[model samples]
Target: MTTHANKKTALVTGANKGIGKAIAAGLARDGFTVFLGARDSEKGHAAAAELKAEGDVRFVLLDVTDSASVQSAREAIESETDRLDVLVNNAGIASAPGSRFKEPAEEIAASMRIVYETNVFAVVAVTNAFMPLLLRSDAGRIVNVTSKRGSIGEEGAWVGRPNMTYSSSKTALNAITAHYARSLSATNIKVNGAAPGHVATDFNGFRGTRTPDKGAEVAIRLAQLGKDGPTGVVFEDDQQLAW
Candidate 1:
């Protein structure tokens, strides 16, 4: 087994709060030098400081929706780290949980646009932008923090919920994972999606049954996959989730 690096670096996007924050803390506890990515510099620094008090952690200003911001983050990371061991796409938006899918065409379209901008487009942009840095590592892993609601099998469950916008965006993200896994099958990179189940997060007004710690479990596990571990798969709580 390869020894863990004393300065292994990982980045978790949208980590100012909720599942993303939990995941970043977990990685740091596991000995990674974490880069806590947040759109808000203030919150990002606060989170990094909280973890830095415990161990090594850095605050990175990253806005997945903005190409320039993503490029700048990539550049900063390149200058600071020799290689990126993990990239967790955990930042997302879920607006209007009670809005019905069939309520209005404009509403549905607007929701889709909002969710897709962060969940789908941002994941692709960050992953593609950081592929080179990941490839430089011996056992690079990419975990797309998705949800079971994204499963096509469960699409019926969200049909009337305008919140389906966030769920469907994740479905597309899973497709991107599969594509990237196939593209890198010959390489050492392992890319997969992790569903945190129904975690109690601000996104849903903290009504979810599971805690952020529980959700972070699968994400941290996926981030630490070995060279031979499975890829192009979706998991929830360490169990295979239906697609």
Candidate 2:
């Protein structure tokens, strides 16, 4: 095994493609030993191989929705490194047909529950599981991938009244970030939510205006924040977003 005792270590979940892949690439380029986590073994290894030219990148199979998978991922990473400097919770799902208001109540609940399983509860689960490794670092960073539509303070001007699926899941994620930051205030951990606005990805059928790299900019930046950087907040770029 290549020794990474002196390098910064990071993990990006759902990093087989899209913005998560971009963030993993960025971190690798920044000289961090990046673990690209994904549910698909083939794709995860492929992505890690593709990123090898950039820097040190490895694959970690992670299914955020399953506690066993989450535990296994944590163990896998822990075996390689004693500490984790950055963790980007970038796995999420888009809205389904039944997630809308006019849909049947049961359908809406099922859709929202699926979304929440990955978007909200999964975040908490992942963070809590890997938190020990994060705290081992001198400057721990947690970047929760959220959305602008999730902001309750701002009206959804662009995509008015986002359904209970994707948008509401992010709203819950933001609140979790706030509480997490508060809980870890005295520690080295800096927890924050990142809104990768309108990224063109398969998740949205390529309707977005921004590229995956552009959408990943905020999460990448947040992951590398210094000890003095802000926590318990949301940001898109340099601009802080409304909660």
Most accurate candidate by lDDT: 2
Return model 2's CA RMSD, one decimal.
Answer: 2.1
The Cα local distance difference test for each model comes to 0.85, 0.89
**Candidate 1 wrongly placed segments (more than 4 Å):** 1-6, 96-106, 154-162
Superposed Cα deviation of residue 165, candidate 2 (Å): 2.0
Looking at model 1, report the run of 10 residues with the lowest lDDT sum: 154-163
Q: Candidate 1 on 196-235: residue-level lDDT in tens?
A: 9888988877999999988899999999987779999999
Off by over 4 Å in 2: 96-107, 155-158
**Using TM-score as the measure, which candidate wins?**
2
Model 2 residue 161 CA deviation in Å: 5.1
lDDT of 2 by residue, 86-167 (tens): 9999998876544445433434566777888999889999999999999999999999999888876555424664354667
lDDT of 2: 0.89
> TM-scores of all models?
0.91, 0.94
Query: C-alpha displacement of 61 in model 2, angstroms?
Result: 0.6
